[model samples]
Target: MSVRIATDGSATTVTASPRTLTVCVVITTEERAEPSWVPQLEDCSPALRRALERVGLQAGELWLHLLGIGLERGAPTAAELVDAVAELAPAELRRHLVGVHVPAWRALVGADTLEAAARGDRNADAVLLADECYYGGRARDSLSLLLPLSVAQTKKRVADVLRRFHNEVFAAREDELVAQLERDVDAKRARSLSPDALITAATRGYVYEPEPELGRVVLVPHLAARPWILLCQHRTTRLICYAAEPESAPHAQEVRARALKLGRALGDEKRVLVLARLAAGEAGLAELAESAGLAKSTVHHHLVLLRDAGLVGMRGNDQGYRYFLRAEGATESSGVLGDLLAPR
Candidate 1:
């Protein structure tokens, strides 16, 4: 759940700069997301309540074993859930299915033997359940609890729940979700290419991690909570899966300042003429003054502002200042129009 990028941009071009944001990746998944969805949700009251009413069959092994412990409100019935998983392969289903007490059961899995988890009073602290096994004389209430259904039942139930959640919530919104992420990637790229590059993204679910080789940041949309984005490492990819929310402006303040400055700078008749003259070729103070029909001092004053704003630069001669747009500033400026002109 952490990523690192010690260097900035490509080594071939800009070389090293400060590493503000290292590696980021965005991925989408209905299946992977289910593990954390109903259980850990901040506002579980609604879903829990709904589960009690609408989720009639809570008997599936995936839901029962994983969401086990205390069933307060939204637990589906055991029979309905077990029936859902009845078609899966027994061996494969057995692999993931477990008793209601998963923590104790998982501990049993990691240990060399069930006896490995033995405590003072109990000879065995946990037990692994496999078809008609734990529920019968071999295990059950002795070392472990009964699995709600067989492996086949758990598998089918899991698939049904996953398919249902996807179609109901995520499928219709997939394209729009991906499109928003693409805009974010484009915006980050624009900043990454700048001279003093920095990435400024806000998320509640994730934080910056340190790594030597930083990969690209991507967006993963989920039926997750707002602003909460989960960051995890996937081989070379740094995946950021977040609870879905509507798209907000990217780096909104930077876009506004850039737009305002550039707008005012171009709003004058005299300044426009000076820009036109400069575009043709480099010009000194006197040359630009003559072309604009303005006094040398007035033109000089404008040139000073342009330079300060990063729209003008000093020539190779050093003595002469030439008015030219900075690539860095333009890169940022381009995104402003894209943001403002975007749908309200």
Candidate 2:
């Protein structure tokens, strides 16, 4: 049997078999910040090789399809990259092709453009979109609208407090400080509003909006893998969590049991789903419920169990709650799961 590995924020699907595994890295480069050129081509080539090696896939045994989109310098367009991938991909494997988009670039151009490029590939297996580096030197920031004046000032005040707190806890890295600031800002924002108002605002700004479609696009990066970890923004707050998949019988039972326990305790489907999804990072609820054909509500019930278990959490947004995967102390299972089953 062949195993399909899809990643978040990507347009290419990778299939691993006894004989071979193919990887298609779709890169769209622009000249806005730095001039017209491929920034990561040289870096990414070796990184891809190393990533594949770590995953037990060798360079020679794999087919590397590089789709480069040159933006603004008479370079390759998004369409060109798609066409190149289509042309290079083996017909049979193309049917199982996976798509990945680097989040840093995706945020600059917009996900719709990337999604449109992949639309022609009908049989794509999974799409991987990335927002930040998992290993954590500098965490990438997803796009967010500037807050209204009132909210912005309030956030600033909270951020100042958090900056100091994080400095004491972590260090002088601005990146880490910013993360702490975001968390504090979110906490304060949640406490300032009612749950209903928070939900409505968050849904409008991040979830349902058409222009950016931040919620959906943010989710794209996590779709390519087994356990999906979604780090979602809700207004001033941010959340991280595992979006578990329960496609198989054993997994489904485990998910249901865990979900039931948490659901009964929490009594909130949205909260539960957010937490459970965080726990199952890279394989969130939508994928898990794919086989069960359950309504979002039914699937959400399972999510609540983990929320109550304190294994998952939700942060308040100006509109709705943003879910997060709580990363507690390290465990053996955390190490064993590697990328797919690791806790957020």
Candidate 3:
């Protein structure tokens, strides 16, 4: 199997250096579970909920538009972050909010589309609809809300919502949350694993194969994102927020969970076929799709299950990620099952 290292002299060899990849552990109030809007309403504080309604800002919208606050260096307090929002240039705010740096999307939407949309240009809707990624009702709703407002108006609304959110919702828990997130970051750094291993461990076996276009990976630990890993994309950086490993479960329960998950992942015939293909060599999504004679999306689903079960690893080049079997995980699956079946 071939291993790909970061080409920018970040590390000489993956095995030789713990920091083989340029991975940064970031902590910020702006790091919400992605799409930032989908968490259950009951999960939100009454103050936050009211603020959302007051401004017609979905919880996700406020964060989606303000996440640039997290991208800045030197973690700022929640109050400072809220204040930073008020100071961003209208164009800068929009750019940061809509960090959709996809080549095709950019080609279709053009350089001036965001400002045009802010200016209430009618053609902006048509341009946005051209991309399949924006076909969703959610995207339409977000566009509706955003496109109607001038950029300056959008900035004011975002700043106001964030200020209220900081004062009412996050301020109380900010220190405690920051402490927990920092502790996770420090503890993970203490492990001194290579970037590949660090990401896999922090994300509980989910490997982020960095493509040629990606220069950096930022891992942020978020308390509100428990039981889920969140991904956000910037021009050259990918931010991943993962839940800290739960300590509350009994050891046996944890083992049983792992064993059962492996069983379920290996139980599927199509997934097994995908694994078989990976065993021969690392392959991209299209190749796996063709080998399995399934749609790309179907193959992608199988990949997710296999990856979650720790049965697969991936590497990236200029084109995209190539999936390979992780021999360690495949070998460990049997031992996991054996432990569950063995005498307690």
Candidate 4:
């Protein structure tokens, strides 16, 4: 049987034969404007678009529904937000819909919103508010645990829709059998993870020790160390170590000159400089911008490119995200510049 996927701006739907699955990607735009909120819609939007694309659904096959809510409150309460969604969503869509809210302040608010959506006692379909719920907090941890549960429920819904569609439209009795097989496969994958085995594997790693004879570069792990070049192997995921020595000053200067020339050739001098700086150590975005002589936004844009190229890495702490060069000899860069920068 054929399947249909549809979306309004706020919600998305995927329908296969016996089941229809409705997902609310965004609950309201007003909550998005909160002072405490950080915009992740850029990342989320791409992920949702990709998921729909993978399932072969185009814009025409999806419906778009917009929730017309104004942004006045610092952050809307779960109840207020839910009322708005229920009012806007069609009654037929309500029964099949699953809301995904990005809570702005408390992740528990997201969980609360999900429960509210399932009950549908309010005027709205349960608003999923965008908030700082997925950062390094208890809510973030809780949300991670909830992900698998949500996936399981959604899978079941889709299977049910497919089974019904096949029987009614395709006149196929094997539809249920096919659905069961899919469920079995999913179950098998889930059961393969044993907690005791995972714990044992994690505890079996050796202590960190340096191999000085491996290269001229010394990794002190000092907070003030300058950025060093790292070479990463893409396939094996190993880093090749290399130290930039004081004696290598002339070569380093030449490499910098070459980098500048390459940057100019690519019409992106700032990016090249940013990559060079990150290869040296963890620098603030502002510092990187100043060193590269570019605006902060421009520096960020360049960093994104460097990050996508696997020349840079980022880790988020409580304060914010810190950018650094991947450690030398940790990744496999073999013949590429990723390797050229590593300690040898």
Off by over 4 Å in 3: 1-39, 42-65, 100-110, 118-120, 133-144, 156-172, 204-215, 223-229, 233-236, 248-250, 263-305, 317-319
Report lDDT (Cα) of residue 143, candidate 2. 11
In the predicted model 3, the residue pairs found to clash are: 36-60, 37-60
Model 1 ranges off by over 4 Å: 1-148, 193-207, 210-223, 231-238, 243-245, 249-344
The order of the candidates by lDDT, greatest first, is: 3, 1, 4, 2
lDDT of each: 0.40, 0.30, 0.59, 0.33
Give the worst 10-residue stretch by lDDT in candidate 4: 217-226
73: Cα error in model 2, Å: 19
Count of residue pairs whose backbone atoms collide, per candidate: 21, 64, 2, 58
Highest lDDT scorer: 3
Q: Specify the poorest-scoring 10-residue window by lDDT in model 2.
A: 14-23
lDDT of 2 by residue, 1-344 (tens): 11222325422211111111001221223222212112232334464434323322211101121211111112232233333433443422221111123333244434554353234322211122232221011111111111112333323322332232223322233343233334433433444443333332322222222223222211111111112233333222122222222222565455544444433545655544444545566344456466345655465555444443445444442233444454541242243234334464
lDDT of 4 by residue, 70-106 (tens): 1112113223433443444343222223323212212
Model 1 agreement with the true structure over 1-344: per-residue lDDT tens digits: 11234344533112111111111111222233122222322233454334322323323222322221112112223333333334435543344333322223333344343323322112233334332323222344322322343334434444454444444443465455445544544444454333222221322212234233324343344333333333333222333443343455467755665566567667678887877787776777778899889988688657644543445543321112345545454565576779857776
Give candidate 2's root-mean-square deviation (CA, Å).
Answer: 22.0
Model 2 scores what on Cα lDDT?
A: 0.30
The residue-level lDDT of candidate 2 at 172 comes to: 39
Query: Estimated TM-score per prediction?
Result: 0.31, 0.21, 0.66, 0.28
Task: Return whichever of 3 and 4 wins on TM-score.
Answer: 3
